[model samples]
Target chain A: MPNNRVVNKTKTVTDVMEEQTTVAPEATPAEEVIVDTAPAEMRYDTVDIDLTQSSETMLYSEVIDMGTSPDNYVGKIIKVHGQYMFFHDEMSENSYPTVVVLDATKCCATGLVFELEGDAGYPQEDQEFTVTGALDYPSSEDCPFPILKNAVITTE
Target chain B: MDKLAEYLQYPFVRYALIVGVLIALCSSLLGVPLVLKRFSFIGDGLSHVAFGAMCIATVLKLSNNMLLIMPVTIIGAVLILRTGTNTKIKGDAIIAMISVAALAFGYLIMNFSNTPNLAGDVCTTLFGSTSILTLSRADVWLCIIMSVLVLVIFVLFYHRIFAVTFDENFARATGMDTEKYNLLIAIITAVIIVLAMNLVGSLLISALIIFPAISAMRLFHNYFKVTVFSAIFAVICAFSGIIISILAGTPVGSTIVGVNVLAFAVCWSIGKLRGTAA
Candidate 1:
């Protein structure tokens, strides 16, 4: 009689286990774990300034050509070493950071404008610095050259 | 050193080395006969023709500029070589006329043809500012094929070339077709000139063709020894020049020519020392 009672208790326990397994999933409302799918800010810690290693005159020429055909360099992360200068527009009272690259002969020069994110301190006029950023063609009416967006500057 | 190793990994640098070495080899091979036959300036003339043709090609917006450049340069070579002796206009004079004319015409066309970055285009064309580094894969392959063809032709017809270079009239009297050999030389010269334009530009192509042979001649009298030495010297100079230019961020064509000039100077000094000792 004690053996029969033990068997009956065992059967009841198994039945309870099956009921829990079957109803547990349906009992919960199927909670959706929503994940944030927004893209992270594209930023680079270090950018290699290969222009210092490349042919200076040719690099200058290439940069000028890129200015003419902005479509070729859009979305490319570029690092170039050049003199840093700021142009203050009298009409708009806006100061723009420009990097001036001189050719090998130093007779010719080309300039590329850049935008910095944080307070990187104002670099001196004609200060040699390496700028790294993504190349962008701004839709601004006054800007004719391609720009470096979200730039990081380093002294050469 | 590490930077150079890294730079070499780039496809453009590899292409530059391949084309540069091949062009140097071909130019030096042809340089031997051209120097001996008093046709050293023909390289300059043909390169000028190539520059002019390139301008025309650019104006016409041709997909492949070599198509126009090759035929025009070949024709210029033929005219320069064929009419050299028969016409009142001497060879050097004709070459000068054509070279200057082509240069002037090319500049004029580029200036007025609405070509963007006119200065940059002219600078690259005239001085070869990284043109070797900017070559496409198709160009590199073409350069390789042409260089091999040039090498094979030089090796196969070495004896005939020597005879023609030494004495064309004697070669003709000896039942050899001197005109045919001259025509062959002209064609090869035109091709080399075209190929070399990327390495040293139109203004410096003559240096690429002349310096090695001249330096080799200073050290060796025999045609075979001179040709071999010229090829070696040209290759070394080209390699060193490219490396130095890359490291120093200097102009590639001028750097190669400067290396050639230095080699010539050293060879001249060595030749003088040997002459004095003897």
Candidate 2:
């Protein structure tokens, strides 16, 4: 695979923690190695852990409602599951990832695009986050998609 | 007489029908040149600009008068025209910038407001509820009058408008003030969009503008015929879409948009078949 690593100038505590664990891959099991980077004050409860077929473990958020639209949670939350229609995002390399529109309503958002705000020490495909962020409504004659203006991926 | 009596029995439904037909006619007429120019996205942009304006008004607890939306949207339209005319930065970039900025600003305004039910109203605006099914007779007359105004403008300006849209350079060389003409048309388009947004809501207004135009374009080659056919098509789709939504218990705006998309798809396929046959 090509190295498309993007450097972070403003590395958060989470980024620093992920970097530390990345070096000790051989000695520890995946769950024990992947520590939550949030300070204990900010860290919410660790509800449960589940591994998909690809063997990536996801920590569930108690507040993340998978049944609801995840657009508003762009900057505030992470790793939320929802019933977003499965469409091949023309812009992304990921073929089967769920697409969340800015409006949360399916019809209102046509083509808004987003990238996960931070790396979650896991594969991009496994790191599904429900984030709350600023939103941009469709304004131009050509732009069909509405976007969550600036999604800050806090936790997934 | 029976139709009139039926409407009298339910004033709101009658109002909705009459208002709906007038809007359908106006949208269909304006939609022809819009489709020809392939600027259908303007309708989408205009509706969103309207959304942003309403969001701000809601946040400020301003009188939810349609007039407040007008000034904001006119500024937005002017900005779009200015940025688009430069043609140095891709039009898409300007659109992207304005769209994101407008939406973000709208949200911030709404979030900070202390109004009662502000968020709920915002949601209603975004999804576009049709409580207009219960609009009073005066409101219906207002809508009808606006629609007529739009229709009359189109009729009067059809020649100059056609000249400008078909070939601006040619029109300019022929001593026509293309820039002035284009500006007037844009203003008209902006007003029409605002009216459409008021009647059907932002979510479905673009569908009303574009679907009939697309259907007519596929079926007819003459501009006049296309406009007439599209008006008829819009009325049918709008009326039927309302009926279908009422029957199916679905979101009215979404259902109408869905109907428009279906019409477009069917018409497109037929056009494809005809092309193959020829």
Candidate 3:
């Protein structure tokens, strides 16, 4: 053996890649999301609030004597807690935007201004809807608030 | 001859026969155009409106003055027809509104009123049973004369009526006032309704208007042929229904309506089969 040549074998990554490849996993069925945070005791009150407020207006708590009294609002624009400002309307404590009193009007009762909503149109609360209607005066004792008449919606 | 002798024995029975034939003729004749025009629902609506008027009359304790119901019913029929022609509210809507409202008003009057037998009386008028069998001589004569008047008018205005029924627009284009013709039809229909209320009762009389026309339509294609055929068919059904009711002791209105429905179904089936065969 006059010239014993040294044999050299080089292994390349591409040569072994075709035999072993990664497979993506199949998609799983989507699950429904649930969000229920309101307590059981105040459910009826929330419902009342939702019933009173118009579907167009948002609910806001009126601070009387620093949270001693929470007044419901509808159709009137008001500021809430320095962060959010919306139309304050009466809604039940349980239901969102539930209109407690669909109609109401402002009157001085026992040295405090009370808004009595009239019962012309049923307005739900916590829903965003723009109402272009006129203010109505008290025509009945049951509801003592101004009403929106010939109201057109800009958005819901 | 024996049956005729029997039917003629009671003056009231004679009256029923005379009144029934007249009503069947009048209704069948006018009903031809109405059915052709596809305004058949008018009969039902007008009848219900007439029923409402009858209820009102009942509440007021108008016994002999029950004839007051006719004018009110006619007025209501005219109103329904006019409103039905409006572009804003369709004919079907007007028919539905008038019928439901009239029935509702009748119910309200019956329920709220402190009158005895008012509800029963209204129910009788509505279903059309109690009125027909007990028709007096005067009612029978009135029905006959009214029917004759209606028939004469239809004969006189045959061409215009046909034109209006076929194509109202073309009728108007040909210098025939379609609105007048339509109003005439409504008025005639109202009068017919009041008359038929005495024969078939208000609730079941519409079948008399609709069935004979439908049966005739199946047998004949031409307008004149259909009208004649419808009258004949109506007479047969009326007589047969009465005879069956007498024999079976069933309600007259139900018997009549049942016979008409059966006849219509048979005719319709035959027509359908013939069409398929052709």
Best by TM-score: 1
How would you encode candidate 1's per-residue C-alpha lDDT over B88-182 as one tens digit per residue?
99999999999999988988877666664578677778888777876777899999999999999999999999999999889999999998999
Clashing pairs in 1: none
What does candidate 2's lDDT look like per residue over B1-278, in tens digits? 44334324444445656776677778878788876766677766766787888887776667645778877777776667667887687555666676677667777777787654455466556655443454555666777787777778888999998888788889999999887766766676677767666456765677778889888878777778878889888888777765554444455567667887888788778877787211
**lDDT to native, each model:** 0.77, 0.56, 0.58
Give the TM-score of candidate 3 (chain A).
0.23
Please list the Cα RMSD from the true structure of every candidate, rounded to 1 decimal place: 18.5, 17.1, 28.4
lDDT per residue for candidate 3 within A16-86, as digits (tens), equals: 12211221111111121111222212212222122112110111111111112222224323211111011
Ranking by DockQ: 1, 2, 3
The runs of at least 3 residues in candidate 3 whose Cα sits more than 4 Å from the true structure, single-residue gaps closed, are: A1-156, B1-7, B112-114, B276-278
TM-score of chain B of 2: 0.88
A134 Cα displacement, candidate 1 (Å): 4.1
DockQ of each: 0.13, 0.01, 0.00
- Candidate 3's docking class is incorrect
Worst 10 residues of 1 chain B by lDDT: B111-120
- Candidates 1 and 3 compared by DockQ, better number: 1
Worst 10-residue lDDT window for candidate 2 chain B reads B2-11
Q: What would the per-residue lDDT of candidate 2 be over residues A1-156, giving only the tens digit for each residue?
A: 113333324344355334433433233234432222332123323312111110000111112122122343333323233223323433432222133322222232222233333442222332433433333444454223434332323233
Of 2 and 3, the candidate ahead on TM-score is 3
